[model samples]
Target: MNTAAVVADFRTYPLISALGSVQTLADRVAVEWADGRISPFHHVWLRDNCPCQQCVYSVTREQVFEIVDAPDDLQPTAAHIDAEGCLCLDWHDGHRSRFDPGWLRAHAYDDQSRAERLAGQPQSHLWRSDLQLPVFEYTALMEDPAALLQWLIAVRDIGLTQVRGVPTAPGSLKLIAQRISFIRESNFGVLFNVQSKADADSNAYTAFNLPLHTDLPTRELQPGLQFLHCLVNDAEGGESIFVDGFAIADALRSEDPASFQALCEIPVEFRNKDRHSDYRCLAPIIALDALGRVAEIRMANFLRGAFDTSVEQMPRLYRAYRRFMAMTREPRFRLMQRLNPGELWCFDNRRTLHARNAFDPATGARHFQGCYVDRDELLSRILVLQR
Candidate 1:
């Protein structure tokens, strides 16, 4: 095949003016961009990512190229910036590939590019009681994509949101969850009733002053999102409480760095063993992402198992644990509300610690149906709506 003819054809395209100088490296092609940035595309990567109909299925947009069959010593024999501003390459294995420079720049893996990508991720807004929680009406959420998108974005960023005027009936919780994605079934069914029960296996089923905690921390993969629909909340007290675990962690980090580090370094055991199921997991109380940002908080004092750390580390762990618990209960970090009937509360289980004030069940009935959904589904729905 004549390589000159391919370059001449690309030159006729409208985007050719954006093309810059190109050089062939030992095993890749370095294309300089009009913005004074250079992006290096490996020969094998270029070949595997070829946008040609023969390499990629036109209908499915799936790759047809076999990575294993690609030559191990593949390198660009001839490379240049085509008239279409694409990095045109002629490989030693007689294979050709053309990559859009814009695409390459957008996907560059350099340090600056990676940092920018991370910065572009959805940011969380820390809040206290003063911050008015974003609320969406159930009817609007069901009928309008914009309303649903707004609620989903708030839940993703703030880790909490409320929906009012939901139908107060059984299975309504699951119906609303279905609007986001499939319900994440666990030891608790897809939809579990949250009323006081005799001989309750969990503290949540009782009418006691439950301390602030994340649910099901004993599980290795804890649920990311939680939905609590207040079907009937007429009892005295039992006000719902929420604390931004991430915000508290950040506060701890600022106030006492040593305690925060200890919480992040020590792995505490959480176990839930009953006649029906035995679940246990070990994880740090404060979890950080690759960038050292607070990402998750797993704390359940009720379900915490025996402290299995060194004697010397025990005191430090206890100090850190107490510090974290104290911060969670602080009024400056807590948001308390009495969820009325026909209201549904949704929050990020991984980042928000929830609790309930003691209520007298004998006074009136207080029922709430609850369920879980993975965070990916919530974010996925938001992305689809944005598109």
Candidate 2:
């Protein structure tokens, strides 16, 4: 729709409590407040000042910026109301930003009121590691297309799923992920792949075995689910092992509160640098939910940088780290699977800690295609389906 229509639609809402009705003419618009107040101007002119960036930037450079101070030269010309009760405006500068009446009514009182991100889903429900992730009969998701979508949603919500009977190929994982939601375009695939390079970090993207750990611990925004499609499983010793890292953390908190408290207090840095890229993040070994529940345990020996611990803290940190490892090795928390050819293993990277059982490279090579989709997309799809 054009700017006029957008603005007209916006003005229908009761923006300011004192404003009642609005009228729009070609060159100007007028507003009637509850207390009989009116401001006449070209609605289009007024819309040019919409807080949204669509009014200010070119299509190629459409980024929103802070609207702290309105430029003096910018002035409203015309105004109108639309079906959505929004205040539409015309600006002398020819740019338009519709003042969404609903938005104004809700937020205009305080200039500093923060817009909070919608409350995120329950972390446990969004990152389940032990609840028997849905396994699909390879032919089902393909033959019953609707069911395939549902499976993808469930996987997205929990951050993983497993499938059997699909042929393992270089592109097979992509095909499955396409079914999951067109492969999220940005930050789209496996974090690491094993390769023949003596230095793994030097070639992190190539096929390689990974230890039990969460991906992107160092990243400010980590990718959600991980897909590993096994094309060839002839190599020995590369059985996939997953541990419920949250469960391990929870147990640690319950059995040894001091260790848990210590971990929460200490900040560990994770870093990965290569010839082309360098990435680093600092977070505690244990992450807790808003309600104080253990949310995630980001422990990766490969990615861990220096602990930066003082002599007094080293002994406690070491003790806690050792205890965590001991709990992780316990059988009850682990689910082991040798993803053979034609098998796909997926998991919530945020909650499940995965490891490789040291495969023999001499026998044959193990090849897998991997990808990822964000957890938010997955959960949204599920809720949509439910509704």
Candidate 3:
């Protein structure tokens, strides 16, 4: 059946109370909780998500039922609430399933429940320049799960942290990165060298001053976490600069709501073309998650393509862009530091704008090994360590 017909048939089930009354309609069932919340579950979904050993593997906890094999008009032959407040179902196909009421309530797709879940998501702790950067020792991070968890939490909450005393040897950055998760390979390979190189593919390979911006905004899925390990820094003038993009965006919202709104509304194009790859994407400079919280800040003047908006909107977009750029450079938001050899600086690429000052590449050598990791993996590692 078509999607609309399926949805229509699914909702035909009457709402039933878990404690007071039980009701079942064609191919569906509804459960009303003690808290007066009612939710309908389609028989197909219930059968697919069945927790029985026959439907789901007991050890691996993975679904074993094949949805395509089930009958399209399948309905529950018998439905009732068990003593433990579980919805027990006997299907027309001679199958039995029981679903916990709490699980059903939590997994409900109703508007109110979805909104509540989004609102309950974890939010970042925006930081300003005055905040001290969280630092952890390499040994502690490698040996103690507690220390590693603390570092991951700091990166998630504050967008940046440092691990000192990392091995300065070549390719050691990959080892440190793997401690959290697998490296995300880009056009620059699994681990790219950050040094002044002749005929460089990107500006990052030069000694020129790089502006505060997120990396690879041209790609649809930008890297989440970035690790830059300072293996050599004998150069004179290459001070690393960082700014909390979310913090700056928040400040802009307070100081100039119009500009903030413009930034959040207008979509800007970011493009990167080279001999090997040509990448492009269109996204707002300030992106918000479903709950209206800052999720990502995609800005890179070097990679930004020509404006494609109308004449009327161009002026407003430029004003907003200029205002946001100025805020990123404000003294109160900028943090400057010279990373020492054996120090690994990791930051949330989505929320942090990193820059580099012009260095005298001719005078002395400066080098760093860099890699990318997804934010989900970092959070997963944190959760596992906590457990």
Candidate 4:
């Protein structure tokens, strides 16, 4: 326990348990934790992950050594639990490698260990019409790192949140949105005005009852985070609507598995055309990650192009599409509220379907500014703050 431990990345891995023993096997190292969990680390895996200054650059914290440069049979000569509870390996080529026990446990590849890690990860809190919305103040988020982290976590898990006490000024949203990362610019521009206009390029700019749908599915990658800041809200009828897209997908899967698969398997086109630019993308209505989990839901009815699937599958696709649309309108899932001046919404664009009831321009002036921030930046900021 007299030695020091070094990590490879710009993150901290807390020591979960002490390393009980290290046994050198024929091709790998067997590590036993104090809790009696065993994890096997191959010789190549250990050598390739060396965190020393020679193997990893100190400033960038990136790997400098490549595993391919080592011999094919690069087995360690000896392996033991160091006094510091780290796994120290002595390779046949006189190379030394040490692994932090915490990092090792966090990355253990055993089935049991992997399952434990997966269970410990954050999960979405599926909500419905009665959801007690997560709310934060704009001043606290900009001033306190702890507040910022909490707000971001809510956005990640709940997929919908609101911020009040914001300045009712044009472009005030840019200051708060930048607290996460850069504003994702589209053909519409960095900050798109959400007001009724005579010549509106999109339904979003008109005073119409927009249906519940995700935004900007016409692009190859939909925007991750969306920010809608209200600067003026004198309108009478434009109430906000929100539905948890993931919750609907889950219910659909349970109620009608066949329809769920249809949406996930069929690919459709979404296009956005204006005098300035034309954007098109072909993707499934429901996108699944490698693990087959619902990673994203892309649906923009206004921008959806004519279905071009084979005649045989056309009826099936339409049935699934109609069923999904029906689920979105179900009363059990919708959340309705009217945002006032100095309030803004920050939600996951990929998981939360948002809409607005038609407002009368003759009633009063209504102005709101909206912007987007990619998911990568939001996750990165969370990690840095966690560190």
- Tens digits of per-residue lDDT for model 3 on 159-258? 9999999999999998878889999999999999999999899999999999999999998888999999999999899999999999999999999999
For each candidate, the alpha-carbon lDDT, in order, equals 0.84, 0.64, 0.85, 0.92
Compute each candidate's TM-score over C-alphas.
Answer: 0.90, 0.62, 0.81, 0.98
Worst 10 residues of 1 by lDDT: 5-14
RMSD of each: 4.8, 8.4, 6.8, 1.4
Better of 1 and 3 by TM-score: 1
Candidate 3 lDDT score relative to the true structure: 0.85
Model 2 lDDT tens row, 170-257:
6767766655555643332342344344554533333456667777776765666777887777777777888777777777778998
How do the residues 1-387 of candidate 1 rate in per-residue lDDT, one tens digit apiece?
222222212222223225578888777767666767666767777777776666776566667889788888877788887665567778777877776654555566667657777888999898886769888899998888888888899999999999999999798777778889999998978898888989788889999989999999999888999999998987999999999999999899999999999999999999987779999999999999998999899999999998889999999999999999998988999899999999989999999999999999999999999999998899888877875
Question: Which residue pairs does candidate 3 place in steric collision?
Answer: none
* Residue lDDT tens for model 4, 17-50: 8999988888888888999998898888888888
lDDT top scorer: 4
Candidate 4 RMSD to the real structure: 1.4
